[model samples]
Target: HATHCPKPFYSSMKTQLVSAIHLQEVELDDIEGGNDPADDKKDPTYTVEEAVETIGFGRFHVLLFVIMGSANIVEAMEIMLLAVVSPEIRCEWRLEDWQVALVSTMVFLGFMLCGALSGYVADRYGRWKVVVAGFFWSAYFSFLTSYAPSYGWFIFLRSLVGCGVAGVSQGFVLKTEFIPARHRAYLLPLATIFWMLGSMLIIVLGMTVVPTYGWRWMIRLSVTPSVVLLFLFWFIPESARYNVSAGNTRAAMETLEWIARMNHATMPPGRLVESAQTERGSWRILLSPAFRRTSLLLWYTWFVASFSYYGSVLSSSELLEKNLLCITDADAEHRVKHRHEEGSVCYCIPFAFSDYQTLLISCLGEVALVPLNICLLNVVGRKLSLALLQFLSAIFFLLVNICTTMLGFTVLLFLLRALVSMNFNVVYIYTAEVYPTVARSLGMGFCTSFSRIGGMIAPFIAQVLMSRSVMYAMCPFAVASIVCALGNFLLPIETKGRALLVRLCPR
Candidate 1:
């Protein structure tokens, strides 16, 4: 076979080792008919996708996992902080129920305001810069929120915190850019463990600290990590794919070289492959024919996922307060009768028992769900995993209305919480995988912002409907879940084991 080939193909062995070139059927005919020796000698060019795929998964990916996972941790803590502290703020300020709900609504409204902007800027400028700014932005506002003199100031600062935390959504795109196609589904779901840990940490903190130094101190302490993450952000690199999409070929080459060196992988000797483009994408493109179906479905799914997840979490502290109080009361009664004292209590206030205990168990639900979610995503892929989880959550919600015993009600709530947590993990992974590099950050941001709309509405749902009946309170989420499950089936693409596209724009 070697003797039959042209002399140029056998002239140098080193080029063969360095290149992944292959002869297509069309090229084979040319080779046989008499092709140019000089053309073959010049070396083949590759696209950015081909070069990056060659580097495979290694050290650079692990660093991305750490940084991006840490961002999720921060976001989870910040989100939980509001629910944990809102009660205390209510008691201290004598704020109305509507006022407290407004405080929760404002945070997500702030998310709505800036979520798209974070994605656009990340796409246009770079991921690292937006993420760095997000860390400091959240930390500053979170710390300032701890010092708010009035309810108005508190709501304003928390809104700013929402805007700052919006940067965490960028983690999905930033990390996805580095991950190899084969490992995307498997690794992305594992990031939820950080979110689980963050949820647990806030509960633990609320249990331990809120009773002593107060919610203000807890907020202040939580902001401390922002400084560390901001410093660490300086060491993180930009996405090489983003570089290529933006037509920064030199920067793209440098990034690929750096990745290859760090991963101990080989780089091709000739120019790095890249798919260059002249113009950046706009949000309007999301409405175009290619993306319209998937985009709308993602928006609906995000909305339902956010509504169910946050509604279950935020309301657990309030809706289950009565059940928790009965348990606490029983223990207090036993201790008082036995010890013959004036009901020596476990916590500073009765409200703390209801708030902290429900919040703590709600977080535990997320922690327990992670392992199961990891398995489901790997086995079933995105659509079924999401549909099943949403359906299960709806069943749990309906059961919560029927349960007569306090234990059964709490158990069902936990199930609902866990299922919603799993739904969140799957949706985040799915959204990150579906869009190409050009529109990835914006796609995620737009969907995330729409989810915040659900989040904004959730407070009112819990506040209004739960007062009528548990069944009534849960109806919207149940309906939303069904809608989402149906929408999941309509998703145009199944991104499992698929290569991340460098660009999705028209030729």
Candidate 2:
């Protein structure tokens, strides 16, 4: 008898059956007798070959993960450039501190508000469509944001590009759904590593663009990733797990065969669930006792994290004072002129010219974020690590106010931003893992929406400090960070190595 499925996933029945048949055939004829309770109990038991064939963990999985990670980096570079390019932007436009902050705040605001609905649609229709929309829209608008001639157009375009991030915000969850539960913790961290690489490029751009051509060029430079890395979309396949759950047999086979070919193995033939049943999917299920509380906490966390984060970045731009430093040095303007005078072959090369140092520092900031994320997630539990970082970030915001010297201020500013960057990465991974399969999309969307609300308000908050001392401006973010840090303490579960839940709502 064919097993039944939830109404929402009714379509994936065939894919479910095929994958089941595939797994069962292998279980039935285990060459290594690996399924035994005693032998499988050992954590070290999974041989590299068996991991590839039986469990679907291998170079192929790594390849897909890397591609996804790099895609994330391409997007991140655009985001970080917002912070790096602010100095030139604020100076040229003669804008206030809040105005500069508005650029990134608006982007996140666009992401926050649109995320929930996109999550729902992805759950009902497909993950691939969501990613496709995000890519096309973000890439187009990101380029448009660069071309904006006026401050109003600049803010409008940045927020519009933010809409693109909304469509693709839950990529971690999508990747989580496709892979096995056991490897998820490690996989999530690895995927974020791509974000690190992308951020690093902006740091490189910072070294080259901001000092020489000015901040507008940094905005123009960011357009490279959105256009170039888009080619990967073709190679990116749909979620096999989503396919299996929806009962699409043909799609299941095609995706599985692709996986097999990617790994060089034979397809297994077994039942999809052996006895799994389902009913049509519904949003009501998210409010079930099992998930409601988790959803609420995640939403709140996103709000606080977003508000505090962008608040700091926007506020930091006010602190750059590089132009001040340049004025003090006198020699600085000559340096800028010297580079522009020479031009061309040396221009594109960041390290080739002297003006690129600030850009280099900004781009290198991304590298600093990498190991920080890996260590925190792997060594410390999610809750403590996030809370700790948020708390520290908040402290740095306040400390930036107290510092007397320029050198002292910039050093603390970079360090705190690095710590917060790590926290931001953790929030992405943890939020996705906390949700079950059914609510993952909406959960992500809702959480991001709250984040956008914070993003939207970050500029206003920054505006309050615009007329005040830089030290005073940071206090609000510091305070909010403390609140978020404390709230994280109440997160009920660790979710570090938990399984991806497949809740089949009974009819």
Candidate 3:
């Protein structure tokens, strides 16, 4: 065969052999000179944080904010729906004050029970999994709640709905992981607009739908947002930080590449460096010496934020109800004289049109404060901003007790809602920033569960106590807010302009 080959072919073979020998000698010399071929082939590596920072905030984040913010809206509607429906539920069931209050309490009871568990699962399994499951769980149960034939079934289903909402918060954790640190202050507070919209939407439904179709139809309609969120779930990628922390470097890289493409940006020019995997959902780490003080103080702050915020929200209807009922001088005097009488006929009317209007107006307070909250977050920072909001909220809670005119009460309530909502926004941003990726979801879950404990107690004070005296209802919230303010001031670390921790300790 070699003899039959063309002379040019033989010449080419000889040239390739000589070139190969020369290349081998050069490579050997390079090896002997302590240069590595593998090193030459390797690209520089970047940490997940560095890659995310380079990707920066853009189109993907706005889409993420909307998707995750919609989850907040759904949760807000579910929670605010309780206050809107409680009056109707009370009238229909002929329930006592405490029983109606129990309806609200049970939802938070379920939330508190499942919040930490959901966090643990999100940390161990995946945030995207938990968030999607939560939406389905909540939507299914909320739909079933409209068909509840009796009080027992209604409360039971509502509690399960709360359980689902607990998991939905992982969406926020997921959103936080992706946001660039510089933009978090601006974007996180703005997310509260969705929550405010949800709150106002339920009130609008209460006014228009409940009067025309009744509360059942109102509930059926409330599930629409959750259903919509399920459709958008496809676009939400799992957190790249989480993927890196879980040691799934390829998945992390793929997600980052997708983010870069979506943002019209470029990823860092290297492989993603996987973080050392840590315990996925360790409660002990939160209580460890490093995070112990911050965790405890944060838990208390969460409790106060929920207690005061929900207390004001639930109490607003009752206060409005009283104002509506007492418009006539004779009726006002009669109510005061017979307020303590046993077996007295109770008026269990649903909120009037004007009452719903008032609620809607109050809901806007959160929106109006967004700009101010952003300023506080950026300028005053997390700790001082939180403390300032809480302190102002306490003052408003107290002012609500002293106000004599309905207009004055409404104004104070509006300001109070604005402050409490801002307080929640700050705490959420702070918590998401402070925890390491290894336990971010779990930490939020634990803190949220503590907040639910406050929610569990709020209805009693807001409904049962407000039914007796304004001071009784408002006093507890005022006290709690003051304590939370002090706790916020004492928080050990401020996360402003700080990078999120990947792990508590190097392994």
Highest TM-score among the candidates is held by which one?
3
Candidate 1 local Cα displacement, residue 497, angstroms: 0.7
**Residue 356, model 3: Cα distance from true site in angstroms:** 0.4
Give lDDT: candidate 3, residue 394: 85
Candidate 1, run of 10 with poorest lDDT: 332-341
RMSD of each: 9.9, 12.2, 5.7
How many pairs of residues collide in each model?
Answer: 5, 42, 0
Error of 2 at 163 (Å): 0.5
After TM-score superposition, the amount by which residue 454's alpha carbon in candidate 2 deviates from its true location, in angstroms, is: 2.3
Full-model lDDT, candidate 2: 0.64
> Cα lDDT for residue 6, model 3?
96
Q: How well is each residue in 1-507 modelled by candidate 3, as lDDT tens digits?
A: 779889999999989999999999988988776465676467487898899899999899989988899998999999999889987887888888788889989999989998999999998889999999999999999999999999999999999999999999888899999998898889999999999999998988888898789999999999998988899999999988888878888898899999999999998886666665768889988998889999999999999999988998988877765442223233332244313358574656566676787798899898888999999888888999988898999889887877355556567778989999999989999999998888899999999999999999998998888877877778899888888888777787888898888888412
lDDT of 1 by residue, 1-507 (tens): 678777887766647654535445556777776464665567577766677678888898888788788888889999988777766776688665577788889999999889999988988888878888888888988999989999999999999999998886787788888887777776887787788778778777777888899888888888766777877776678888888888888998888888889999988656665666544456876877878998999999999999999888766765643232223224442222111247432221224454466566667677577778877877888888988998888777666666354455566667788899889889988888777788888888998899999999998777545644666777888888887887788887777777776667432
- Measured against the true structure, the TM-scores of the candidates, in listed sequence, are 0.85, 0.75, 0.90
Minimum summed lDDT over a 10-residue window in model 2 is located at 344-353
> Which candidate should be chosen as best, given lDDT against the real structure?
3
